[model samples]
Target chain A: MTDLNPSRMAMVPFVSVHDMMRIVNGDGVAETIAAIADRIEADFLRWEQFDKTPRVAAHSEEGVIELMPTSDGERYGFKYVNGHPANMGRGFQTVTAFGVLARVDNGYPILLSEMTVLTALRTAAASVVAARHLAPKDAKVMAMIGNGAQCEFQALAFHHVLGIEEVRLYDIDPAATSKAARNLAETDLRVVSCKTAEDAITGAQIITTCTADKKQATILTDNMVGTGVHLNAIGGDCPGKTELHRDILLRSDIFVEFPPQTRVEGEIQQLDADHPVTELWRVIAGKAEGRTSTSQITLFDSVGFATEDFSALCHVHEAALRTGFYLDLDMLADPDDPRDLFGMVARADT
Target chain B: MTDLNPSRMAMVPFVSVHDMMRIVNGDGVAETIAAIADRIEADFLRWEQFDKTPRVAAHSEEGVIELMPTSDGERYGFKYVNGHPANMGRGFQTVTAFGVLARVDNGYPILLSEMTVLTALRTAAASVVAARHLAPKDAKVMAMIGNGAQCEFQALAFHHVLGIEEVRLYDIDPAATSKAARNLAETDLRVVSCKTAEDAITGAQIITTCTADKKQATILTDNMVGTGVHLNAIGGDCPGKTELHRDILLRSDIFVEFPPQTRVEGEIQQLDADHPVTELWRVIAGKAEGRTSTSQITLFDSVGFATEDFSALCHVHEAALRTGFYLDLDMLADPDDPRDLFGMVARADT
Candidate 1:
């Protein structure tokens, strides 16, 4: 920054992974998820004010990297995230992310934060948000299929926010289920480690399928999903990858984040192009119906969206401010005279 | 970044504005521009290997914010930039930018750099690249129509690279011309500050126009341009902006970086949709002719491209490595167990 206008405009508050953990600890896990959910829901209600776009993705043989950008006329935010299926074998997370939030008026970034933890929190919060309006009024049990990285976050989020007392968990690899169960040992929720997807979904009002696969696989059959249950299909996100049988989608009232994107990447890709689905924002805003009857099967086809990331970044930004767990990065150059940038660089050392 | 892969994979090298100065001064400014131009040209030679896209811009009344992303199979890079002409009045730069270079294989950022200074360097380098191929062999004196932020850099680049012995400068405001003159006073090249645009182009064979404007405006006329001269039309960019006359465009043999983008944003937008123009990369690759005759008018319609930025980043990444002028940013999260992201956060406290 220059001599006259130095600190405020040039320095951006950056929250690292270490600081993210500290902030997460300062705010309890489930409570933070709920807080992000509240922000997501609030942003969803006023979705019309935003300039939205589907995440721009670059696909390679390894996996994919994506940039999700959105601006609410006032402030702009974007997340840079990658999904590499083989990363887990190399001791790397299948998905890692970071995000930035900038002012729309001057296009200056205000906050730069690690979003790996925040993405997990936001994904769970978004599920809870959809379940709030789509799930049964008296829902108490959540069956988590493919209990891996997102398992505990989802379980804790549902346990605290949706009043789910028990989580029935199952994964193809029994070791994963055991890890999730052990992690939830301290939590108040009753953790049930089941053997099969059918066993996992037994007597549960909400079922979450988030198995990781590079190719298409039906983790859940139509016979496994009962009426009056809310299904959160998360792992069938990219092309050529899906989790539920086509018949199951036929029976459920599908809700989506952004239909144009969800139609191409979500579980709904198995259905027709014009298949009627409710935009989740419309339901959140009360402009459309959620769950009409107890017999209705509701499914939130969750591929994730930019606005949810935007909401999460904003929520975490406020949390960082309150907790004082941020470092200022001198990422932008400011000169005494805007037109004399070369002169600033020339006289920098002096 | 974690314990197992903490040093190599966990920490990202971050170059700030102060360090960028160290780099520019360490390598003389003219030499740095020439090196960046070499990288840009090398990338241009292998342009087919890159995934290219025009920048995604979010426009507001105040200015516009843009994201320019590209990948060359092995590496990926993107820049975040904003153009707010009114920022100069508010004691802020009209344009500010930052960029990131990441491994395409795993999507981990290898370099994070402040591009405010680099952008100025890359812009000038790109111009000289065009002039080298399009300008006359005996071209000596260069005319600078806009003496703003980009003026002095252009003059120095041409002086060092193309052997432009003199620079004739002009701007609507005399102070801008004076500032540019003062900045270049230490150099060996003769600096002539002119009262009018016509006076500036009197004896120069190469002309550069980079005045800032938000709408369409003609800074140069067809009659003012002479035969055997090279025109570097840069000021008129964006959808509604251009700096050259339609008649001037008709007379000149135009060459552009990318035809699709130049058709919409460059000075060639004034010409017909099917007006014949040579792709600059083809010319660089020897697929097309550059200067058929010294008498022909050559115009390099320079709208900067993503590959140019990618080259600049790769170049600067190497330079920062050699100079050791970068800070390590703990921007990514690496957990021991790939699927145990929640566990990592839960245990980060200890």
Candidate 2:
């Protein structure tokens, strides 16, 4: 029989921020992104087996806190994340996250890890996964319109996984562009810091707009987006946030992670409720077509979903266990007899 | 300016099972229960200030996992809990939990703690808080049916907070009764091990039913419960799981923590949709009646509300901080510049 004592079943593996960094650096960020992307693909392929729901969110004056939960009948996962756009001025990250993965059979948490860094990696990987099928064939030149926290990961995921040789970066703030250029200085990709959004998308086949504003701003107008390019729009993910003009959404054949959630938080929020967007999982599962024609304007309305977090958590759990980079936290209370919890507390008096 | 480095705002205080026990034992269980009851009462008095919602649950064949979240516009708290009735046979706790408390202003967590032990403390405290208002004056005896993990805490909370001087314990399993009797031998209250449920409620003015079976079990028959006795039904807190008979519910003046939730999960699930049950917060706020006369039967149909967890989290956060009985967990990622997350990870390569 399994030991039902505090010494045996009370500990849960926890990967701290420091340990997460170690795991990423040890395995290489590019490699981690590739592995996570593969896991996301595998999960997407079997999407019908999982239970899904729109995230539960508590919106406040300052920001919103959300709990995104999903389960695959065998494993359950959830991420607690917050987005406070004004937090950056107060010396806090605009977004911070942590997540837990548990066994569905017993509901005991198996792994807990910091997800702020992992989210960036998975977001970029998810974009690349969409691009691999939706972007034009042999696409090599990409435009990144947000030179901020997620820019480098998007640039690297494309450079390493999809073999994009050059990246055109642009930001409203020139300092952010300089920072991205300086960070990518060591990489082999030809990094060009452009002066404007138009300059950034010049001759690019993939345009990724990931700005950090929390308002409706038309970063990509209909005229600016040409045919035969994949637009990965990820920044406008809240109720009142949008990055593309309504004309652009009307012009492109949009694909989304989940329709019910995307209709509220994705760029499609500006379009009619019945605007007819394709579910990305259908394309991934080979049930629908992707990039049907070379001249098609394919746009991936990318709002990060819970399944991607589940995949990232699965990857982090395995990597942490293999590399021994996690702490066993005494997060659960296991009494010798489950009915004697009071006895456990009373006996501690000794 | 506030420091934006990873070392500054990234750490959250984590109170483990060992640390929680230390804090509880250090303060004394009776004192801790009293303090928690005070906090719960205080929060209940101002219940309108909170953003309340029924717990979001994911049920499976083996068990159910739930997330209970609430905020008072300034602070946010949520608990992750699971209930697996067959877990005891598999050498696991029937229920286990953990919770997080965060600052709503910035959406950053301030505390994370194991709540298996704390839940016992708060559940007992909440029961006492209810009994204080609903139980007949000068009631000194409580009949505790199904003496399990929560029996001793209930006994102690009644003994210390509600002036109950004696407790009658009875369970289908004699071993569970003996465990409760043995655990309570050190207390000042009189503990009696009864042969049956009828014998247990012989002279008791308050009755608490908290069995573990996930089915309709008539622990309290309509004829067995006399007039003027307050019933605290907690075990039957999920769909299709009910304790008292429907006839018993029709005769009692039902008071619930949250009516919308209790209508689905509490013992009142057996009743009609618009059963005219009273909200407990109204009584606490002095806006509704509790027990009108000595012959009135008052039932507290508690499915456990999110506000109770929020109050318990507040108490634990304060106590943990006061005693310094917690570990600083590097849970959040705070880069030197919020947008320079990639730079932070890149520099960690060194």
Candidate 3:
């Protein structure tokens, strides 16, 4: 065999955090979120075509690491993400992710990308997509509790996709609120730094609770929330971790992504195993109702799903290729003689 | 946040295919196999400490892609691998893999390495580790039925770890046999290329079956096997895939990695659900017997477990850090303030 000169087939296109940030900033954060949201909505319509599996997670004392994999027959995608709220206190991001998309026919990875920035974008996009159906019509303000990594993205996505003009930010750490407030000031959306969660949600038709830390911590109580509010609950994602009070869950019309996972990880984990919740995809696909009554509270229990990541990955793969915002990573071994891997390695020495 | 200058912490050490070959050729195949075997043995001894899960697999008509994840409390590791026999006909590898090793405490990936070469080495090491206990004590001559990518690695591993002096190789494809024979010729061990499986196993104490691309095809029947021989069945992983006939499995004392997973994917898939197979860890841990009698036929139903990959990754993580045969990938977003993720991305525009 000829000496192993690695070819293009061996190189997977890798979009690092730098390029991911570039893709977000260059495309304009709101435009990127809207594009990804469109993909998410489109994929949601073809949900049955994809193989969906709940993320496999390893939970330790410090945090949890998860592998979320999904495939759409033609392509396969998976995200390696970690959630450690403690990480933030120690100068590490609370959540970080990377993903790979491979061709299902050959099982060769074609794209590798940092999903940190992209996940933030996707998470924000998912909320806006859900709110497009569930939020109170004429919703002008979004109350974003727990102003951290996802806060500004959520504000921008709402501004682009849902026509929300103002965002109210609140966090247990006032500094996090200031950081989020400062970032949102860069965008056209009016940013308000609230003193408390209750203050943030006041007069807001869409209240998004994304607080981190403390299992079973009720950031929003039944009395704190009024009627006709759409709640996008993205935190309290793991088992034994929940953010809402039980009374609030009983009053709301809940919607979830994959019941089995949502029951264990979402706010409904506080409720019964058989608590009725609408499938978000069904609502998006026009198979189920999203919001029917004017005075009804609709809650989107967003624990984050594989399909959302898969959708974002599909978008990034195409964008990276089109814009040349990726590096070729020599991640696979493609020998001239497929059966001569050892010979290829041996020849490499020469 | 300062304009996103990715720090060292943001970088993950990546061992690409080229560096993987350099590491393999730099360390020598036999020696590397032995070193990784030692790590596998050490990890197996503390087997109970690991959080073991059967690989999460997405099976398509063309092939299958699997994610194998395992954690040992402090550290986490996972491998992404795919198997498409048809890929070989299209000039792609039948199996390609890559893996990541991360700190469980902070949920940060420390190493990313091309696992195709490492997997070949680890697979061989695992077989040799099991054979050390189960193979005939005086085993010197070995027969490898499939002279494919793994054949040369298997020969070198056996030569270094088990002191095997000679190897007999055979493949349905004559060129594969010649390639394996040529690769083995470079080493001190004697190499014999044969046209048929029966001719290859003549007078051999250890018989290794590593053929691919078939479902339930019996490469080794009961009549071909002799008493007091060890069979390293490395192929036939995944459902509906088997190399040995039922009669051969009935006679041999079957040993497996993980029983629940093995019962579904290993040769034991052909056996009853209750078919008793000794866990290989017990034998290594001295809690169970290996080969009891001289005439006993020992068969290791190797489906390739996650711990084996985790052990290999741990080895690679250390080797890469030591030798610097790796690239530092800007895979993670390490913002100065964890809550300022949006600020970090926005500032990168400047």
Candidate 4:
């Protein structure tokens, strides 16, 4: 007979941000990102195995906080993320998050880690993953129009993964552009601060737009978009929030994470429901075309799906376990007698 | 003028099960529960101020995992929990959970805490909060069906908050009953183990049926119910999972946490969409009728809502902060150069 005390089942494993940074640094951020990209791509190929749904968002006057949950047959995961566009005024990042990975067999969380930094890494990795297939061949020059927290990651991802050599940066906030340039100072890739979005996209083979605003900001007009440039629209992810002009979407062959979610929260929200777009998984799985021709414009409408987080979470779980960087959390009740959970608390008194 | 080195946010505080137990033991569990009950009531009264939505649930063949998120003006909170009926066979508890509490002003997580222990506390506190207003005056005995993880908490909260002196417990598993009895050895309230649900409710004034099964189980029959019995039906929480017979609901006045959510996920899922059930908030606010007559049988068919969690998280946040039983988590990117989030990743020479 098993003992009925729950004190024995009391520890959970947790990885801190410092530990995560150490792992990212030790593994080489680019290599770590590449690994995560592979995991995301592989997961995307088997998209039907997941229980996918549109994220549940609670919109307030300041911003929105959302819960995105998904599960395969054996594992379950969810991410808690908040988007407060006005947060910079209060010294807070525009987006912040954390997530959990759990075993579906027993409903026990196997891993819990900070996802703020991981989201940045995975978002960049996901963009690169899509661009590698969709961007034109020899796409060495890129335009990044956000120059915020996500700008540097976008630049590095392209430089390390897609072999982009030059990046033109533009932001409404000049300090943001200066900061992005300063961060990329050590990298071999050339980074230029541009005065306008049009100047940033001049001669760029891939243009990535990621401005942070809760309004309908037409950052890029159709006339400014050049042919053969892969447009990664990363911001403008909520209802009533959009980045690309509707004309740009009409001209580009668009690809998205999940079609159902993208229709509401992606740049495609500006387009009609009947608008034809390919699911990124179909392109990754070789069923659909990504970059049909060198002259064709491709757009990756990334609203940050749950499957990417699912992949990133699994990768982090393995890394945290192998590196021994996580603290034990008593989040599960392991009553010696599994049926006697009440006794676990009672034993705590002893 | 703030440094944005990318990882410079206020630390996130955490309260583990041990930390929560210390707070409860130090402050007196009953007092802590009473305090939380007050918080829940206050939040419910200002319902229009909150951003409320239905929980996001991922269901599998074995059980279900859910993310329940809600926010008032200042703070946002969410819980990650799973319910697996077969977990006992694998030596795991039937349920486990953890959650986050974040600031709405900046979208940064202010606290992360284990909700397995806290869930038990909050669920029971919510039951008591409803029973105090809906149950008959001078109610002193509770007939508790299903002696599982949530059984003891229900017993203690009623004893501590509502002055219930005796509890009649029944479970299909005898070992579970023994565990409940053992856990309550330290409490002054009397515990009675009964052979059947019918035997348990012989003369009890409040009948709380909290069985654990992921299927439709008629734990309560209409013939077994009595007048003036405030039935706290807690176990029937999913689409096809219900505890009481449909006839029982027809005979009693039904109340719920959130109607739209309860109509789909609570015991009332067995009823029609236009069923004449009252939101528990209405009764607490004195906007609707509760127990108007001694012969009235009121049912609080609760499928635990996010508002209750919002209250529990806020209470725990303040308590944990005062007790200093929490650890700080670097869950946000506080870039000294906020735009240079990539630089926060210390690059490798390789």
Candidate 5:
């Protein structure tokens, strides 16, 4: 038998947080979000081709860690994400994530990347995709409720992808609203800082709620929401974490990413298990109605599905290849003789 | 507000294949296996403390990819593995794996390691752990029915951990037998290459069947097995794969890792759903009977479980820390203010 060097086969491209930041900045955050939104829209059009499963989660006293996996016949991808609401108080991010993409044919991982930044981009992009299909055609104003880590991305995605010209921001913490207002000062969008959620949603066509609390707090009540509005709820992702009141869901034509998952993790978790909700993919595929009438209240109960992460990973893998912004990580063991794994380890001694 | 740098919180230690090999060689494979086996045993002793679930798998036409996750109160771990029987024909491994270990409190990954080598070590160690409880006290010879990738590790583990003096090997392919024989040439134990399965198990007290076919080929029959022999079946891990005859399973007392998993993926998949089997942890925990008499036929229907991978990851994490054989991967996005994720990405531009 000839000695085969497994180093080449073992090398997997790794995009760290630093590299991910570079990739986002290199293309510009709004441009990157638009590109990922395109990918997400394309993937949603062919959603039936992908394998989708609700994320497997382990809930602890302090937080929950989840593994979300999906495949599109040709490629497979998964993301490891943790949501520790208390982590922020302990000088840690409330959410952190990483993902991998592999070939379905050979089951070899080709790319590993930090999804913390990518997920934020993808989440905002996904919201834009939903709003494009569900929102009123001439919608230009967006009310950003519970302004936090995701506020700037949401504002930009809507501004660049959905053409929203104004954003009204509000959070329980006055400092959070100020931070978001300061960040969006550079963008062309008209930014408004409000003292209350009710004030933020006034006269807005699009309302985005993305609070970071782990409890079931009603960031938007039934009386607060107005007619002919699109609600992009991003913060009520986990089991106990919900943003909108049950009355809001009852009044809206709810669109979800995946029903089985959204029924358990989204704002609709407050609704019945068998509530009639249209899958957003159906709207993208032109099989179902997104927003039937101008006065119809539309709510996108976004829990962030696995396919979105897969699309984000696909985008990152392509960007890494095009820009050369990644390191090759030797993460797999490939011996010349596949059966000679023990021999390879033994030879390492010499 | 203070500017906080999250780079330190984002860095996760990664042990590459080269680093894994260095750690294994530094501690010696057999010694490492013994230490990991000790950890596995200790974990099994407290089996009820863990949150166990069947692996989440995505099966394709060519192969299956799976995510196995388990968590104790303090820590969580998961392994990503794939089984593609045709991969070896294409100059790739039949199986490749990697794993991560994280702190449960913050849900942040602390370590990532290549598990192809660590899996080989853990499988052998797990086998030794089972053999110690199920195999006869005076068992010395082990009949290895399949001389494939896992052959040498199994041999060395039994030889070193269980004091097995001889290993008789047999394979349908002569080259596989020769490979196993050649690899074990430097060991003190006697290596006997036999022509057939029947010849290999002639006078052995323990029989190990580890063939890699994805079909139900009976490597062992009821007629071939004697009274007191312990069977270690490792290869029939997925559905439609079984190494031993159903009649042999009917005759022996079965012990399995996790019943829900073993029932679907282990050799016991050949049996009825209601077929009784003892959980292996019970035997380790002194809660159940093992090897009632010298004549009792004990069959350990081994299907790899998540806890085994967790133990293996735990072992690798410690070894890497002790030997400094790992790289810090910037996989998470940490900002001084947890809510200012967009700010972190924006600052990278300047």
Candidate 6:
């Protein structure tokens, strides 16, 4: 294999969902989350070099399909994600995604993996990465609002990445809350099921809202939040989907992924366009402050950025190669006779 | 298999590049070309219902990576393609691509295949579809400038779809011209290698320029273009990457797959944004006239639209299913407990 024939070089490796599941499972969730968080922070610090675009979305009656792409001269990563709110009714997930990472020099895919589980992992990793800088250092308790598929990842990430000792969970769906609780039953972190969103946030130093309704919903109002409560707002990503109340955004010191995208999709979308929100990368690069004072309210408005996917892709490319759990997809043409693609077809028949 | 459990009701077949090449070779190129051409034209006629967007591109110093996505309410398709002009120096093809087609209802990918070859096939099919409508009814000859990897597909498509009997080929690389000439030798259509671009277009009713330079190279200047010649501009797809002279665009009655995209990535990008160009769908829908007079020069400014991919995806989906040439990709999680993605991981490790 090291001889490096052009014909063998044409094959692209495809990482299946099963393969990705194995990689993540084999590596252990805590280690994978920590590794990806490190990657995200590293990628974010050098952010200006990337070619970024607000995702292109195709909206339908049921849901939306989006394509998010970014590149950094050397490699390009894109995630194809669909948000079908009604999919859960058919025993499918509300969000299902897959991503590709390619070498920009040759334009050949280096990684193709199921991002349904990986997205959950990266989103949680990103949230914790931001929270570590913005949340109080001694913050031991975290409140998680809207316990769904993403809830376990959030719970595990905060516990593993931020050293959160306790998690208070609440959701409209009791079954979803139970699922999160059952998933975390074997873990060391204490999981307390709360009756309501307010009950969950009562004594928690950090509040994480991850509700998935497409419509604007006030999961966290000003009355429910207090000083020094670091808010990690997820799930309020698309245009009309929001989680925090208007007053909560107005009162808190906010940090965001990309200002251009966060302004439209984050909790800050409820605020004015000129609102002085800190970019997360600036804090990672030591150019801006995070959690200025013990008593100051801080909010991490995370709508999931392409850079996080870029970082996760880099991590997965290395892991998949190390594990050799992927299949070699015949995804490119033979370079022996570049113009003889027709011959590939002709010879197959003969 | 037919008396399966309800969960396995409908199998969405997929075709890997290896299997697709086998199918194409087994069926014969002429037969495959005709079938693909038929699918393309039929799909083009119903283009109104499609969800179309200009491709999202991440451009680097050397090239660009783009995601072209579109849907027809029932099925969604997207192609990840890259154009690295410097890649040929690195012993890589200038363009490499792969794509997916998914059920809109379930957001489950039905077909995933290598588009490096399919792209060549579809791009040519699109040109032929446009030429069939935009070219003169009695057009029988084509002038193919920039005879490179795409020239064979163009020749075969034009021959099979537009009834083109002869092709005059010209390229900066004479070897490329000879390669194209040699590939088309097996076909009934006569291939003539010309010494210059002007000689190629001498008496042809249709002129197709499929050059590969990443810059604005004028393969067809206004002087070489005579009256009533339909220009199929196939290569000038990215911003600042153009093949035709601006004056040639100023003179011809242009038709495009998607006008907004053609304005930025096609030859029309050289013209003003306010330039009046008709959408090819309107002509296919019989709402507008095509090639009004034999003396009227009509041009199909092709940048390769996403809708064409949606059409091709459906064609591939059906073809692969009927022939049973697909690998089942474990891309989505159907947990025994749908909520227990972590359980899948835990079980895998055990």
Tens digits of lDDT, candidate 2, B65-122: 9999999999999999999999999999889999999999999999999999999999
For A1-350, candidate 3 gives per-residue lDDT tens digits of: 38467898999999999988877777888999999999999999999998998899999999999999999999999999998878877878778899999999999999999999899999999999999999999999999988878888899899989999999989999988988888878678888899988889988999998877758999899999899999999987889888899999999999998898999899999999998999999999999999998899999999999999999999999999988999999999988888888988888853
Off by over 4 Å in 3: A1-3, B1-3
Q: Output the chain A TM-score of model 6.
A: 0.96
lDDT for each residue of candidate 5 in A115-164, tens digit (9 for 90 to 100): 99999999999999999999999999999998889999999999999899
TM-scores of all models?
Answer: 0.98, 0.98, 0.98, 0.94, 0.98, 0.94
| Per-model DockQ against the true two-chain complex | 0.71, 0.80, 0.83, 0.54, 0.80, 0.56
DockQ of 2: 0.80
What TM-score would you report for chain A in candidate 4?
0.96
**What are the iRMS values of all candidates?**
1.4, 1.1, 1.1, 2.5, 1.1, 1.8
lDDT of each: 0.90, 0.92, 0.92, 0.84, 0.92, 0.83
**Deviation of model 6 at B50, angstroms:** 2.1
For model 1, the stretches where C-alpha displacement exceeds 4 angstroms are A1-6, B1-7
lDDT of 3 at B172: 90
Greater-DockQ candidate between 5 and 6:
5
Candidate 1 local Cα displacement, residue A62, angstroms: 1.4
Ranking by DockQ: 3, 2, 5, 1, 6, 4
Q: Per-residue lDDT of B196-304 in model 5, one digit per residue for the tens? A: 9999998899999999999988898889999999999998899999999999999899999999999998888888899999999999888999999999999999989
List the candidate 5 regions with Cα displacement exceeding 4 Å: A1-5, B1-6
- What does fnat come to for each candidate? 0.67, 0.79, 0.88, 0.63, 0.80, 0.51
Alpha carbon lDDT at B252, candidate 1: 90
What TM-score, to 2 decimal places, does chain A of model 2 have?
0.98
Sum up the clashes in candidate 5: 1
Kindly list the per-residue Cα lDDT of model 6 for residues B104-200, writing each as its tens digit. 8767777888787788888888887888888988888999998877888888888887789999999988988887887788899988999998889
Winning candidate number (DockQ): 3
lDDT of 3 at B307: 96
